[model samples]
Target: MIDSQLSRAEDPELAVQVQRLHQLKVCTRWLGVIISWLVVIPFVTWQLQEEIALMRDHFTLAAVRYALIFNPISAIAISWCLGLTTAVLLWQSGNILFGFSSRYRHQLEKQVRRIRRRGKSHVFWRWVIGSKNQ
Candidate 1:
């Protein structure tokens, strides 16, 4: 079914439709990510407030200080990790959802390999001298 859809995209009208569908899917995926964060942020904040009140009532001053300070620091560190992970996952999902063909991937890999083979000096000199193709 997917292969037939891909082949049908060779037609201009079908290609346009395929592109629109891909865009809609990408948009919906991001909307899902946004909606999830919206629901999670408030729930997490509520839980944190309840936990903090418990900490203040029960723990020692030193313990409370540690919790107060470290809690946010740790939350920030964890949030950063989660955000990075989400970003990478979302990007990959977008690529997959938008039909980044394996042929393009292989071509990109070949280009990268060729550049790596040229070495740093060759690339640098090419840029410095404004040369196109060695």
Candidate 2:
């Protein structure tokens, strides 16, 4: 299905824009996922409870203590994820700041503006489908 979308996108100009936007969106999602894991993983590890039937019972939870204590795990996890996020954000920040840097972003914004005015599905279709050749 994705191959089809990429192939379809290759055929037109709009498709290229969609593909790039898709790429950007994917990067964004990955950043979120990696960050979440960074927090959750070491968290379970620090509390020394990676697996269990139940994470919490009536009145005790290691997760709570791990989070509250002066453990480096939390700091490390947050730092790791944040460090990566920061790197990515720093890398992309220039593009976001310049907006003018990538003609693609410009084109994307143009498409958005046009779509708002014309209200046509074809606009979206083309933006996404144009990427196959790309």
Each prediction's RMSD over C-alphas, in Å, is 14.4, 12.5
Instruction: Give lDDT per model, in order.
Output: 0.55, 0.55
Question: Judged by TM-score, which candidate is best?
Answer: 1
Task: Give per-model TM-scores.
Answer: 0.41, 0.34
lDDT of 1 by residue, 1-134 (tens): 46545555553343443444445545666677676667666755564675567776887776555654656854664475568558858776768788567564344334444544665555433332223334
The TM-score between candidate 2 and the true structure equals: 0.34
Clash statistics: count for each candidate? 0, 18
Cα-lDDT of candidate 2: 0.55
1-134 in candidate 2: lDDT tens per residue? 46444644664544555555556555776768686776677665655453232344523566555443655665566566667677767756765676434455446646544653554455454444444433
Q: What is the lDDT of candidate 1?
A: 0.55
> Which 10-residue span in candidate 2 carries the lowest summed lDDT?
50-59
